[model samples]
Every structure is written in C-alpha cells, then in structure tokens.
Target: MLDLERRLRGSKQRLLFIALASVCILIVLLNIGVLSDAPGIKSTIIKVPLRGDRPYDTIPFPTSDGSDFEGSYQPEDAHPIAGLMKEADEKWRKYEESRSKTFRETVAKYREKHGRHPPPGFKEWYKFARERNVHNIDDFEQIMDDLRPFWAIDPKVIRKMAAKLQENPDDGIAGIHIRDNKVVNLTNPSWRSETLAGLISRFVKYLPDMDIAVNRLDQSRVVVPFEDLQELLATEQGSRKMKSDARDGFTKNMGHFLNFEEPTGDWDNETNPEWFPYPGRQYMDIAKLACPPESPARNENLTVEDADALYKHQLGGLVTNFNLSTDLCTVGPAIQDQHGFLYSASSMIASKRLVPVFSECKVNVNNDILFPANMYILKDPRYVYDKTYDYEWEDKADTLIWRGVTSGGVQVEDNWQRMHRQRLVMLTNSTLMSDQEVKILTESFEEKGKYENFSHFEPSVFAKKHFDVGFTDAWGCIPGDCPFYKDIWTFKEAVTLSEQFKDKFLVDVDGHSFSGRWRAFLFSKSLGIKATIFREWHDSRLFAWRHFIPLDNRYDDLYSIMTYLIGTGFKTNPADNYANNNNVYVRKHDFEGKMIAMQGRNWAQRVLRDEDIEIYMLRLLLEYGRIIDDNRDEIGYSGDGSELDDFDKKHPMPESPPHLNWNTI
Candidate 1:
C-alpha cells in the first residue's frame, strides 16, 4: 500500500511540472508575435513583404537622368547690381495686394455662409502653403539674384566693353556705361542700391566669400596640415603655451569679452579635450535630465507613436546638451584662473564650432562632417537626379537593401556603437528568412581581410533566439570601383552592383558616428527606413512617415516593423490584413507609401541643394562677423586690415547695443 502511494505522489508532481512548462511556452510565443496582433510585433519566422505593384504597370518612380543640377556658388560681389532691392520691395507689394484682395473676398464669403468671418489667424491657416506652393518675395529674389547677379553685364554690354578695352587693353579704362566721363572701369564695383535694407542684404552675400578667402589665406600660412594644433592638443604643456600666445594679441584682436582662466581638473582619459572649457559628463547628464517626459527612455516595447515622440524630443532637446549662457558664442562655463590665456576654440561653444558625434556612451566632435555632397555630387555633378530614382515602381525590387563596412563593431575595446552593424548582419543571415526581405552587402566579422580583426559574431546571439541564423560569406570589396569616389575605404567598394538603392525600400543605419548616406537615402524616392540614435542638423525639419520611417536603434524591431509596413499598405491601413508571423498572404497596393516617398524626395531636393548650402554658410559667416564687429574697439584693429581690404573693406555693423533709438539712425 505504501509503494502505491509513493508512485501516485510522483505522478502528480510530473503533471504539475508539465502544466507550468506549457504556460511559459505560451507566454514566450505570444511575446514573439506567434499570436499577438499588437502592431509592429516581430514574428518568430521571417518572410518577405507583399508585392503590390503589377508586373506591367508603367508607374515610373519619378526619376532624373542627372542633368540641370549646378555646383557651388562662386564669389561674385565685385560690383553691386542696381534695382535688386527696389525690385524685391516692388514684388512684395504686388503679392500683398493680390493676397489682400483674395483674403477680403474669402472673408465676405465666410460671413455670408457662417454668419461670421473665419476665426482669427484664418489668413495664416495654412502655414506650409506659402513655403510649399508660393515662394516668398525674399526667397525668390535671393535665388534669382544669386544665380544671375544683376551686375553681370549683359552680353551686348560685355561686347561694347571688350571693344573699348581692345582699343587700348593696357591704357584705356573705359567704363561699360558713360559715368561723368570717368572710366569707373574697376574690376570690382561697389553696391548700386542705396536703400539700407538692400545694402545690408547685398553686403551679407559677399561676407561668406570674404570669410572663405581669408580662411584659405590663413591656411596657407600654417606650416603643416593642422600640425601646430595637433601638437597642442596632444600635450598639456603645448596647449598651455598656445593658450598664452592667444592671450597676447589674438584674443584682444577678437575683443575678448570674458575673462580667461585655466581649467581646474586633471587631464585624464575621461576628460574632454582642453579646447572644451568643461568636462563632457556635465553636459551629457544635463541632456538626460532635460529629456522630455515623452522620451522613449521612459518605457520599452514601444509602438510607432512612441518612436515619433522620441524624434520630436530629440529635435528640440539639442540645446540642453550645452552650457547655459545668454551669449550664443560663449564656449563653456568660466574658470577662475586670471593668468590663463584666451583662444577662440576655447572661448566658442563646442556645439557652435562642431557637430557632436556619438560612438556608444562617449561624445566627440567633428567639424569636417558635412553632407557628402562635396565628396560625391561635387565629384560628378551630372549624377544628381532631378527627381528621385532611375526605375519604375513595378520594375524596382521589393527587397529592403543596405550596404556598408563592418567598422565600429570590431573595435569593441574603443567603440560600443558597432553593435548596430552586428545586429544588421544577423538579420540578413537568419535561416527563417525564406522570402529574404533584407539584402545586405557587408564583410562578416570572420572575413579574412577587412574584418579579420573582429571577434566571432553569431547572429543568434544578437538577434531573436528562434531565427535559426546561418553563416554567410563576407562580401568584402566584391563588386569593385565605387562610382562615388576613388578612395572608398568602407564596404571596400561601392555596393551598387545589385542596384540596391533602386529597390523599393532603403535602410540607413549609423556608421562610426552618423550615417553618411542619410541625405542620399532622403533623396532616393524609396521608402527611407532610418535607424539611429543621433541628432543631425536637419532634425527639426524632418517628420516621420511624411519624411521617412523612423526605426528603433535596438534594431530588433526592424524585421517586424517592415513586415507590418509592407503588409498594411505602409501603415495607411493597419487592419488591411492580419497574420500570425512576419509573412503577409494578402497583397494590396500601397499608394500612400509611394506618396510619402515622393514627399521626402521633393523636400530633400528643395532644401538640400547647393544653393541652400551656400545660403547656410553665408548666414553663419554673417553672424560671426557681427560678433567681431560688435567688439571691434576692444579688438584694437583699425578698419585697414589687409584681410578687410581684400573683401572690399565692408565692415558689418554691431549686432547689439544702444537699443537703436530712432533719432540715432
């Protein structure tokens, strides 16, 4: 009887264990989207997105054959052209008249229909309409004037001037137009418009040119390529000596506004460079504290809405990463060392001088990190597309495409940011990827040449456990010859062989610091899938879905998210079809997705042009000039510096002071 009781007790224990194990398995399955319908859930199994375009559909993805784009703006402020400001003012007046008339008619119609005029701010109801549909007077004149400076003599006028010059090329100083019998035949002329507004606008355009010329001249004076600066940065004593020299005259020359002092901390590995007036950790903590309540760091397992929220916060929170100062140019918090010397880089805020770089937990700065237009499009300007892509929607492959180097991941001892690259490799090699939605071209960590230094990377370790990942050959420089540049370091070569960018979807992930090809992706006219944890100069201007799809940095969510997007008409209709795994059986055309792509392309083409770059650089120079001009007295420079004379000796007015009493003007 006792033996029988023991057997019964053991059987009961075994039954309980089985029940618990089944429950746990069910929970795991649900979390992994085996049964969950929660949006953007990852499927344990991988598959391709539904192809909505027809085989013979002639819907060409709007493209251009790389003509009509122009190069950098040339310096042409030799002479000011006439009537530009007057022309601009007259244009504004006409627009105001037309708009006022239309607004009056609208108000009358609204009163008749609703018994009251439209609420306040009705005229400004559509803010984007003016920027999108109608170019403002200022914008129109700026572009036109820059492209064809009014001072550029007409072809007929040029011929007359040439004829006069030929009569006596060396002796004759004949003016293009008769001016009081005086030749006034100088190569560089003065501004023609007398209006203060016009004069300022015209003067501002040339400041950038002058700034560039001066910088070039200064660069020539340096003995070696950043040699002195490099040595100073490498050692503490050299840095201190350089600081002492700056205090002697150069600091005063720039109108030293703040008192100088030596840094009060050990120059350790954890500290920022001496040029930065404070430690990096201080500002980094401030950024974290200033994170808005809606930041994604507040929660996990986020949805698309959460991602959008994070993007907005990042766009606005850039200011929190710097020290507080009413003066925009203040470099950092002050120290109390009166004997210390002042240097511009030390006195100017780091963010103002350089864009911040993120490699794992550390932050660095790089001023040379401009958009790749200079390196790529400048090399072959004809390659720029007037529209977006070079293929039709139906002809383009539906796969998600990416190609880059395995850079940061291998340097685990130095950089933690490389995990994103590793995660990408794993997704491409997943055994469950029967449809192969993701097509990546990159060297594997085990590759013999480039990534041989990297340690072993198992896809399953970085990705979901059920992926059943497999090994794939490292595609180190297989296709050969980068179409972009000669010295293509990463990817070993351009991975344009598969025509990957021409694919329906493009993935842009961060490299060592930031994604260099993000702007290209923005203008690609493909569904841009951006996955990063860094903020760029264009952050505030970007909008998710309207601009590009924002993917989480963790990258695990990409597979599930892409599945959701392609299956649900790119989220236009989230309920179009429901599936247990990443596969979608139902195929529906995603017209809205195409529209989003077009919008993104249009925005990039409009704002990221060479003309736009010129304008940005010009504005920055103007601001710096203003600061220097404001403190000219303390700087002890007469208006006779050779550099000033080179740029027409046109000194910018003080930006601040004396509240401009009307009578003073």
Candidate 2:
C-alpha cells in the first residue's frame, strides 16, 4: 500500500481514488448489514471505481490535441497554448516545492518512496552532496526504479552477470570500476569512456567499490517485456526476508575486477533463456513488447488510430502533458516512421532481458539508466553557446531555425521522407506535407475571439519569412540510396552554433538518439521549440511551456505553434480577405517568446550546471552501490538527522509569476 502510494504521489496521476473507494466500501458494508446493528438494511450509497480501473484510458488531460476540430473559437484563445502554459507553470511550481529540503526530510522521503531505510553509505553520499552544495537531493528516484527488480536476483548472481557482460566485448558495453575512492577506467579512450570516467571522478571517492557495466553504443540496450518486468518487480519487492548472515554494512573490497568466485550462469545458475538479440534490423515490433498491453504502440490498429489522432483537431491541437507526450510506449507506433530508432537504429544490438546499463539517454519504455551526455559535459566549442557571439531574443531575427545532418536512424531513399530531420526540413522548405494549409491560431473576423483556422500557407514563403530550417548534410541514408537524397533535399551550407544563435527561436529535434544540442539551445537567449522521443536525466527539472515549447513527435502541431508565437500576416480586414492575398498580416508575440526564452536560459544555469551533473552522478552511484551489495536487505544508513535545518520548507522558493496579461483589447 505504501509503495503504491509513493508511486502515485510522485506521478501526475490522482490519488482521490483511495478516498472514493474507501467511502464506497463503507457504504456497501453498511448496506449489507456488516457494519449495522440491524439485520435487513438493503440501502446503498455512493458508488466508486476500483483501483485496478481508471476512467480515462489514455492521458487524463481534458484539453484536445486539436485533432478533431473544424470550427470557430468560443470567443477566447483559440489555441489551448495559453491554458497549457498556466497548467505547466502550476505543475512545475508544485513539483519544485515538493522536493525534500533537509537531511531528516531526505531520509524520510527515501523511506516513503522505497518503504525501506536508505542504503549504507547514504549519509556519506548526502555529505558529499552537501559539501559540494547540491540542491535537489531527493530526485534520485530513477536509480531505485532501475535497480529494484535486481534485488530479487542474488547479489552474487548480479555480480557474476555484470562480470560476464563485461567479458563479452562483443556486447558493446564497457566496465566501470571504483576502488578506494577513484574511478578506474579499464577501457580504451573514447568519448563515452572519457566522459563516464570524468563524471565519476568528480565524486568517485564517495561511492563504494562496485563494478558497473555501461552500454558502449549510443543506443539503449535493455528492454524487458512488460509482463515479465512486472513479475520481476513484484517478486523483488515482495521478498523482504533478510538472509541469516546479512549484515548492516557494505562488503569490504567488493569490486572483483571481472573475476567472480561463483560459477557462470550457464551451469548451476542459468541465465534467462528468453534474452533475444536483434542484430541490425527493424526492432519496432520487439520494442513494442515493453509497452503495457493497452498502449497504442503494442497493436497495429491502435498505432494507426494514434497516427491519425495527430491532427484529428477538436478544441485545437496543442501539446499538454509533455512527459506523457514523450512516452515512447504510447508514441512509437504513431510516429515510428518519423524516427530512426523505430525503423532502424544504427546499432540495433539489444536485449529483452534485464541488464543494468548506464546510457546517455533513452525513450520512456527503455530501461537504461540515464547519465549526463558528453556533449554537455565536454563543453565542445561546436555545441557551446557563447553569449558574446550570440544575439538576444529582441536583437535576433524572429524566425525558428534548425540545421543538422539527417541522423535519426539508418535511413534509405524510400524512407528518407519519413525521418524526422528530413520531414521537418521538407515541411518548411517545400509543400510535400501540406499542399497549402498551415494549422494556425488567428483572429476570427466572423464575430469574436481568437480563431484556429487551417489557413492557406506557402511553405517556401513561410520558410523565407518565418523560419530558417534546412539540412546541412544528407548522411544516415544507405550508400546505395544516398544519390536519391540530394534529388529530394536541397542541402544548405552548415552553420556554426553562433550562426544559429542569430535566430530568436531554436528548433531542436531527435537525431540518431536524443539530441545532445538541447543543453546548448536552452543556454541561449532564444525560445527552444523541441520535439523528442527520448527522455534524459534533466527531464524532471525542465518544464515545457514554462522553459521551452514541447512539440509532439509527429510534428502536426508545427504550424499551429509557429503561428501562436509569430502570427500569420492577415492584418488588414482578415474577415473579408481570408489571407487569400499576398497580404501576410505578420502579428508577432515577441513578449511571450522572449519571456520563455529568458526563463529557459535562467533555469538551465541553475539546475543543468556541471556541478549539478556531478551531484546527480554521485546520488545515482550511491543507490547503485546498495543494489549490488551482498547484505542489500540489511545494510542501510541509520541516522535520525535531528540536527538538520528546514530552510526551504520554512520559506520555499518563489514560483514564477503568473502569465502576462496580453492587452488584446
């Protein structure tokens, strides 16, 4: 009950079901005379739903994704973007305030979340964070969620499994070891190896001696089937009995350097025989197994329905529940063709069994543990944002700009048009997607409020006027199909990071994996319009609409979002003209755009800093340490923490001010 409650509390889902269920249970008991002195009482009261059942099968958000609408506005903001902003700001504020402030609270929070004491050396981990001035201490929940099922497997079995994985160089994974407070890099120097070593070195001395296996490839590796994953989790969490020899401290010198004392799993302890590996082909069907039985990605028909739902616009198609929007389980089937990973990841080496792997980023259903990307940590000049070389939102051109090679997944000539980078470029530069219409929020000349009209638009003209999107290179496609790409796409000269900074809106999308350029984009003085299927460590800290605009993976909401910020040029008597003439009424919302741009820039500085990266790594390592310990059930940091101050609790951080009152009147 406590574990379920903790999960629900952390989720955006409601907890009102508990109270409603309880009341209905009481009424039923009374009606049956189980709680009454009288014998024949057949009266009933309030009915309620069971915990197993949910009213809304899909995302609980009421606002439409603008997929089923073809009508005028209700004398109000035609787009739900304004309402989205309000809800986003409110959600972020509540989450920020809900973070545990002090040591006692942090320990209490850990217990509340896991229903167990903090692992041994947790105090040391806390001290390491406090000494380095770490802020968000209680946000290490992902580590637990990743490591929980492993608790069902014996610690010896886990150590042996990791050792075996490390032995298989063909597995495309590297070994990370910690000994006497130093990260031992036992692999050849590479970007991932160096970055992992550098990140761990920041506070490796604080972590216990343990062996870690990290995916060497850029792509995610492990993906347990939903049913199997559920069983693993339930078994792990249900068995709480401690071994007779279990102690309350970590084993001394537990890092075995690839030499496990126990026999290999193939002998006495056989590994899961169901670990199927897809070499290098389409893995969408295989990947879909990770989603729940009900998600759209799990079925062919549901996926088609989801695909059509992209703009099927009811109350105006706008993004809400940014997290849910990024969920790969629900999103993959809808926009699989638009993503490379779905159709063909460059390295499709994968597993359907549980394996601990530290990765840079992953989609929601993927089980890989996330770490800070090397692009952000390395501070490469190619991806860095230098304010001295950049323009402010007000000083820059009022246009959204994007420039990148086509690298989402391995693409081919036939599939080139479906890939995200290619599709985005096509949507802006040509009329491949839309013959002439662009979904937009504009003034309703008919009678009142803002109007959401699928207005006529020229992609080339819109690109020339409001966007600077193009492909710098046509790579990713098969060599045999490479010649056909140039026929379809007109490649432009590649621009530098500073060159892109000239635009007021930066568009970031997924590449072969998660875009590493997001951090750089956020640091700039421009509103970031990002659409991605991957989730990263910074996801919990970043709020869409408040910091950045979140776009759906399908990108059907593209024109609508663009028009909301930079209006259609339908100014002079739009009622009569209907924007049919070349008279583009170019109405701009510079204030709103600049507001979000500055907010994103400011927030990135505080939470996405290098120090914060180190803090997160340290916290993740601490949790990982407990999972691999022989006395995992017994060992824990036992401290009352009576001496901690509650400054944040007493006076919480002030929330961002309310939405600006636009003087439309």
lDDT: which candidate is best?
2
Instruction: Give the alpha carbon lDDT tens digit for every residue of 1-665 in model 2.
Output: 99998897866345577777888898666655733637564333323435423212221211111121122212124346766665666676677778766778888787777877787667767666665555567777667776788877777766756655655566677777677778755542356767778778877777777777777787888887899889988987786543434344676766434644453345133343234556336666777888887777765557555634543344335676677777766667677667777777787677777777788888777778788787788888887777764664545787888989878777765776777787788778744543566655555556444554555554455556787888777676678447887566577888888778888889899888888789988888778998988878888888898889988777777877786677665565665233353443334455556667776777787677788888788778777777778767777766665544553355343333333223222
Candidate 1 weakest ten by summed lDDT: 213-222
Clashing pairs in 1: 78-189, 331-348, 331-349
lDDT of 1 at 586: 20
lDDT score at residue 100, model 1, on the 0-100 scale: 20
The residue-by-residue lDDT of candidate 1 on 1-665, one tens digit each, is 99999999999999999999999898777766744556766445422224433311223323332121122211111111111212322333453343321323433443343222222222332121222332211222221112121112222222222222212222211112111222223221112111111222422423311111011000001111123323323442221111111111112132211111322233233222223222212232222222323333222344534443322222111111111111111211221010011111111122221111111111111222222123222423333433334454444555566666543222222221224554564455444333334311112224311211111222221123222222122221213221222221223234452355567777776544455567766777576777554434344344554556655444544544343334322223434322222122222224434544665676666555544444433333332232223221132111111332322223221121101011111
In angstroms, the error of model 2 at 195 is: 1.9
> Candidate 2 at residue 42, lDDT?
36
The parts of candidate 1 lying over 4 Å away from their true place are 1-205, 208-389, 413-418, 432-494, 568-589, 631-665
